[model samples]
Target: MSKGVITVTDAEFETEVLTTDLPVLVYFWASWCGPCRLMSPLINLAATKYSDRLKVVKMEIDPNPLTVKQYQVEGVPALRLIKDNALLASSEGVIGKDKLLSFLDEHLNSN
Candidate 1:
Protein backbone atom coordinates (compact mmCIF):
# COMPACT_ATOMS: atom_id res chain seq x y z
CA MET A 1 0.00 0.00 0.00
CA SER A 2 2.92 2.31 -0.34
CA LYS A 3 3.33 4.57 -3.36
CA GLY A 4 5.48 2.07 -5.17
CA VAL A 5 3.10 1.47 -8.06
CA ILE A 6 2.24 4.39 -10.34
CA THR A 7 -1.20 5.10 -11.74
CA VAL A 8 -0.87 5.59 -15.46
CA THR A 9 -3.14 6.90 -18.19
CA ASP A 10 -3.05 7.60 -21.91
CA ALA A 11 -1.47 10.98 -21.27
CA GLU A 12 1.35 9.52 -19.17
CA PHE A 13 1.90 6.26 -21.03
CA GLU A 14 4.77 7.41 -23.18
CA THR A 15 6.79 9.07 -20.48
CA GLU A 16 6.02 6.53 -17.80
CA VAL A 17 6.03 3.13 -19.49
CA LEU A 18 7.60 3.65 -22.91
CA THR A 19 10.51 5.70 -21.65
CA THR A 20 11.18 4.04 -18.35
CA ASP A 21 14.59 2.53 -17.90
CA LEU A 22 13.25 -0.40 -15.96
CA PRO A 23 10.76 -3.04 -17.00
CA VAL A 24 7.13 -2.00 -16.52
CA LEU A 25 4.25 -4.06 -15.19
CA VAL A 26 0.97 -2.51 -16.18
CA TYR A 27 -2.01 -3.73 -14.18
CA PHE A 28 -5.14 -2.92 -16.15
CA TRP A 29 -8.14 -2.70 -13.87
CA ALA A 30 -11.48 -1.06 -13.25
CA SER A 31 -13.15 0.28 -10.10
CA TRP A 32 -16.26 -1.80 -10.47
CA CYS A 33 -14.48 -5.08 -11.09
CA GLY A 34 -14.49 -7.36 -8.08
CA PRO A 35 -11.44 -9.31 -9.16
CA CYS A 36 -9.58 -6.09 -9.73
CA ARG A 37 -10.20 -5.07 -6.16
CA LEU A 38 -9.08 -8.47 -4.95
CA MET A 39 -5.94 -8.45 -7.06
CA SER A 40 -4.91 -4.85 -6.41
CA PRO A 41 -3.56 -5.46 -2.93
CA LEU A 42 -1.28 -8.23 -4.14
CA ILE A 43 -0.19 -6.14 -7.08
CA ASN A 44 0.63 -3.32 -4.70
CA LEU A 45 2.70 -5.64 -2.57
CA ALA A 46 4.52 -6.96 -5.60
CA ALA A 47 5.19 -3.38 -6.64
CA THR A 48 6.87 -2.71 -3.31
CA LYS A 49 8.86 -5.94 -3.37
CA TYR A 50 10.12 -5.44 -6.90
CA SER A 51 10.48 -1.68 -6.82
CA ASP A 52 14.17 -1.80 -7.59
CA ARG A 53 14.00 -3.86 -10.77
CA LEU A 54 10.46 -3.28 -12.03
CA LYS A 55 8.01 -0.41 -12.10
CA VAL A 56 4.40 -1.39 -11.47
CA VAL A 57 1.63 0.74 -12.87
CA LYS A 58 -2.16 0.69 -12.79
CA MET A 59 -4.40 1.80 -15.64
CA GLU A 60 -8.14 1.96 -15.47
CA ILE A 61 -9.25 0.61 -18.83
CA ASP A 62 -12.40 2.69 -18.71
CA PRO A 63 -10.43 5.87 -18.35
CA ASN A 64 -7.70 5.00 -20.81
CA PRO A 65 -9.50 4.12 -23.99
CA LEU A 66 -6.56 4.97 -26.21
CA THR A 67 -4.13 2.92 -24.20
CA VAL A 68 -6.55 0.00 -24.01
CA LYS A 69 -6.93 -0.05 -27.74
CA GLN A 70 -3.22 0.44 -28.25
CA TYR A 71 -2.32 -2.41 -25.96
CA GLN A 72 -5.30 -4.57 -26.95
CA VAL A 73 -6.34 -4.91 -23.36
CA GLU A 74 -9.64 -6.80 -23.26
CA GLY A 75 -10.24 -7.59 -19.62
CA VAL A 76 -9.91 -6.35 -16.08
CA PRO A 77 -7.08 -7.55 -13.82
CA ALA A 78 -4.80 -8.00 -16.76
CA LEU A 79 -1.04 -7.80 -16.37
CA ARG A 80 1.03 -6.42 -19.21
CA LEU A 81 4.80 -6.50 -19.15
CA ILE A 82 6.64 -3.92 -21.16
CA LYS A 83 10.24 -3.13 -21.85
CA ASP A 84 11.74 -0.41 -23.99
CA ASN A 85 8.33 0.57 -25.35
CA ALA A 86 7.62 -2.96 -26.57
CA LEU A 87 5.18 -5.27 -24.94
CA LEU A 88 6.92 -8.44 -23.82
CA ALA A 89 4.13 -10.38 -22.16
CA SER A 90 0.50 -10.14 -21.10
CA SER A 91 -1.59 -12.27 -18.74
CA GLU A 92 -5.20 -11.99 -17.72
CA GLY A 93 -7.21 -12.88 -14.59
CA VAL A 94 -6.36 -12.77 -10.92
CA ILE A 95 -3.34 -14.63 -9.68
CA GLY A 96 -1.89 -15.26 -6.26
CA LYS A 97 0.91 -13.11 -4.84
CA ASP A 98 3.47 -15.89 -5.12
CA LYS A 99 2.70 -16.41 -8.79
CA LEU A 100 2.88 -12.71 -9.42
CA LEU A 101 6.18 -12.42 -7.61
CA SER A 102 7.54 -15.33 -9.59
CA PHE A 103 6.35 -13.74 -12.82
CA LEU A 104 8.10 -10.52 -11.94
CA ASP A 105 11.22 -12.32 -10.94
CA GLU A 106 11.33 -14.28 -14.15
CA HIS A 107 10.75 -11.39 -16.55
CA LEU A 108 12.69 -8.67 -14.73
CA ASN A 109 15.66 -10.96 -14.42
CA SER A 110 15.49 -12.18 -17.99
CA ASN A 111 15.58 -8.66 -19.44
Candidate 2:
Protein backbone atom coordinates (compact mmCIF):
# COMPACT_ATOMS: atom_id res chain seq x y z
CA MET A 1 0.00 0.00 0.00
CA SER A 2 1.28 3.43 -0.91
CA LYS A 3 0.78 6.74 0.89
CA GLY A 4 -2.68 8.35 0.47
CA VAL A 5 -4.06 5.33 -1.40
CA ILE A 6 -7.22 3.77 -0.02
CA THR A 7 -7.13 -0.01 -0.29
CA VAL A 8 -10.64 -1.03 -1.19
CA THR A 9 -12.00 -4.58 -1.19
CA ASP A 10 -14.90 -6.25 -3.05
CA ALA A 11 -17.17 -6.01 -0.04
CA GLU A 12 -16.69 -2.25 0.22
CA PHE A 13 -16.51 -1.33 -3.46
CA GLU A 14 -20.03 0.04 -3.83
CA THR A 15 -19.99 2.17 -0.72
CA GLU A 16 -16.49 3.42 -1.34
CA VAL A 17 -16.89 4.19 -5.06
CA LEU A 18 -20.47 4.47 -6.28
CA THR A 19 -21.71 6.37 -3.27
CA THR A 20 -18.91 8.87 -3.06
CA ASP A 21 -19.72 12.55 -3.59
CA LEU A 22 -16.40 13.36 -5.16
CA PRO A 23 -15.06 11.90 -8.39
CA VAL A 24 -13.47 8.54 -7.66
CA LEU A 25 -10.30 7.29 -9.24
CA VAL A 26 -10.07 3.54 -8.90
CA TYR A 27 -6.73 1.87 -9.49
CA PHE A 28 -7.29 -1.75 -10.42
CA TRP A 29 -4.09 -3.56 -9.52
CA ALA A 30 -2.58 -6.75 -8.18
CA SER A 31 0.47 -7.83 -6.16
CA TRP A 32 1.87 -10.03 -8.92
CA CYS A 33 1.45 -7.53 -11.73
CA GLY A 34 4.66 -5.74 -12.61
CA PRO A 35 2.92 -2.79 -14.20
CA CYS A 36 0.75 -2.38 -11.13
CA ARG A 37 3.84 -2.29 -8.95
CA LEU A 38 5.46 0.26 -11.24
CA MET A 39 2.39 2.44 -11.15
CA SER A 40 2.20 2.47 -7.37
CA PRO A 41 4.31 5.60 -6.92
CA LEU A 42 2.33 7.48 -9.52
CA ILE A 43 -0.86 6.42 -7.82
CA ASN A 44 0.46 7.77 -4.55
CA LEU A 45 1.34 11.06 -6.20
CA ALA A 46 -2.12 11.40 -7.72
CA ALA A 47 -3.71 10.52 -4.39
CA THR A 48 -1.84 13.33 -2.67
CA LYS A 49 -1.89 15.88 -5.49
CA TYR A 50 -5.61 15.59 -6.05
CA SER A 51 -6.49 14.85 -2.46
CA ASP A 52 -8.90 17.76 -2.24
CA ARG A 53 -10.92 16.98 -5.37
CA LEU A 54 -10.58 13.27 -6.06
CA LYS A 55 -11.00 10.13 -4.04
CA VAL A 56 -8.18 7.67 -4.71
CA VAL A 57 -8.89 4.00 -4.26
CA LYS A 58 -6.97 0.81 -4.98
CA MET A 59 -8.74 -2.45 -5.72
CA GLU A 60 -6.88 -5.77 -5.91
CA ILE A 61 -8.26 -7.89 -8.75
CA ASP A 62 -7.90 -11.25 -7.07
CA PRO A 63 -10.03 -10.54 -4.01
CA ASN A 64 -12.32 -8.08 -5.75
CA PRO A 65 -13.62 -10.25 -8.58
CA LEU A 66 -17.17 -8.89 -8.53
CA THR A 67 -16.17 -5.24 -8.98
CA VAL A 68 -13.68 -6.15 -11.70
CA LYS A 69 -16.19 -8.32 -13.49
CA GLN A 70 -18.87 -5.69 -13.17
CA TYR A 71 -16.57 -3.03 -14.60
CA GLN A 72 -15.36 -5.48 -17.28
CA VAL A 73 -11.73 -4.59 -16.61
CA GLU A 74 -9.35 -6.44 -18.91
CA GLY A 75 -6.01 -5.87 -17.20
CA VAL A 76 -4.11 -4.73 -14.14
CA PRO A 77 -3.00 -1.11 -13.56
CA ALA A 78 -6.24 0.16 -15.02
CA LEU A 79 -7.15 3.63 -13.80
CA ARG A 80 -10.87 4.32 -13.95
CA LEU A 81 -12.42 7.71 -13.39
CA ILE A 82 -15.94 7.58 -12.08
CA LYS A 83 -18.62 9.92 -10.81
CA ASP A 84 -22.30 9.45 -9.95
CA ASN A 85 -21.79 5.69 -10.28
CA ALA A 86 -20.94 5.99 -13.93
CA LEU A 87 -17.71 5.08 -15.71
CA LEU A 88 -16.47 8.30 -17.27
CA ALA A 89 -13.06 7.29 -18.62
CA SER A 90 -10.05 5.02 -18.01
CA SER A 91 -6.38 4.49 -18.73
CA GLU A 92 -4.53 1.22 -18.90
CA GLY A 93 -0.91 0.16 -18.21
CA VAL A 94 1.98 2.09 -16.65
CA ILE A 95 1.71 5.64 -17.92
CA GLY A 96 4.20 8.42 -17.16
CA LYS A 97 3.57 10.90 -14.37
CA ASP A 98 3.26 13.90 -16.68
CA LYS A 99 0.64 12.21 -18.83
CA LEU A 100 -1.10 10.89 -15.76
CA LEU A 101 -1.34 14.41 -14.34
CA SER A 102 -2.55 15.69 -17.68
CA PHE A 103 -5.22 13.04 -17.77
CA LEU A 104 -6.23 13.86 -14.23
CA ASP A 105 -6.24 17.59 -14.95
CA GLU A 106 -8.38 17.12 -18.03
CA HIS A 107 -10.89 15.02 -16.19
CA LEU A 108 -11.00 17.30 -13.18
CA ASN A 109 -11.46 20.33 -15.38
CA SER A 110 -14.19 18.71 -17.42
CA ASN A 111 -16.03 17.45 -14.38
- For every candidate structure, what is the RMSD over all alpha carbons to the true structure, in angstroms? 1.9, 2.3
What does candidate 2 score on TM? 0.94
The TM-scores, one per candidate, come to 0.94, 0.94
Tens digits of per-residue lDDT for model 2, 1-111: 223889999899889889989898999998999888889999999999998899999999998899999888898889999999999889888899999999999999997
Assess each prediction's global lDDT (C-alpha) against the native.
Answer: 0.88, 0.90
- Candidate 1 yields a Cα-based lDDT of 0.88
Reference-based lDDT, residue 42, model 2: 92
- Measured with C-alpha atoms, the lDDT of residue 70 in candidate 1 is 91
